[model samples]
Target: MKSIFFILIFTFSLNIFSQDQVLDITLKTLDGETTNLKEVTEKNSLVVVSLWATWCVPCKNELDAINDVYDDWKEETNVELIAVSVDDSRTVNRVKPLVNGKAWDYTILLDTNNDLKRALNTAIVPYTLILKDGEIVFRHTGYTPGSEDAIYEELKKHL
Candidate 1:
């Protein structure tokens, strides 16, 4: 069933170990600056790559949850959260205003072609991958309340 596939593969519990699969992902930031996943990891000890859409309620919720603690998280871990909006061309227009309106401090990027999503092997909104030392350390999707705690805990370990 579709639900089964999502639960099994889309859930955050799934762990991806292959470095080649997640690295070499180059995407344009919302500001039109080109960046690679590994580059961000190099800049920081840890990097959180979140694939989301402006229209996804759960995706919005996850950002909202992190906006509260992100500043402190930065202070402690020097971790950077790159929020990639997977909004297709149709809805991409609103990504900026929505993010600006929400006041989320995470770095925003645009993946209109979904290059990163395809590389990561999951297209579902709200997919999150944590990269440490240029390797994916953890991955999760479809967040529930308090999932941020689990991610923060993992980040703590990597830091």
Candidate 2:
């Protein structure tokens, strides 16, 4: 009974730690400048973090959809979007070219080591979450057509 009690305590402690670990990750810009995710979130009232990959079609579609109305989003809600590429070493080279070609307006960051993905305990592309004052307020994975509308609604709720 004592051992079981200790195990339960340890599990509860780990859950608390993971809850705060999301924003503490360190990521780099495509230009190789290192920045902490928490610092980035602190600079914005609301931040939308999209964990994507170069090869994921749904990810690209979601970002492209968001980019179309991003300016309005910024103007209305002052929300900032950060697109974090979860590409590994083999396909990481495609990220810069793809971003350039798409001309996306969001801040792009590199997660070459998948540190953020592992930290978030997510295994899928197109994972999106909203952070308010550096704390995660919402999380969603996968995407469908017109899903950006849903995301926008969620942002408004937090604002």
Best by TM-score: 2
lDDT of 1 by residue, 24-142 (tens): 76777777788876666588768888989989999999989988999988999888998988898999889988988998988888888898777776768799888887777798888
Q: 1-159 in candidate 2: lDDT tens per residue?
A: 999999889867754665543557898898889998888778897999999999999999999999999999999899999999999999989999999999999999989999998888677899999988788888888999999999999999988
Best by lDDT: 2
What lDDT score goes with residue 24 in model 1?
70
What's the TM-score of every candidate structure?
0.84, 0.87
Which residue pairs does candidate 1 place in steric collision?
12-140
**Candidate 1 local Cα displacement, residue 3, angstroms:** 15
Whole-model lDDT per candidate: 0.83, 0.90
> Alpha carbon lDDT of residue 69, candidate 1?
96
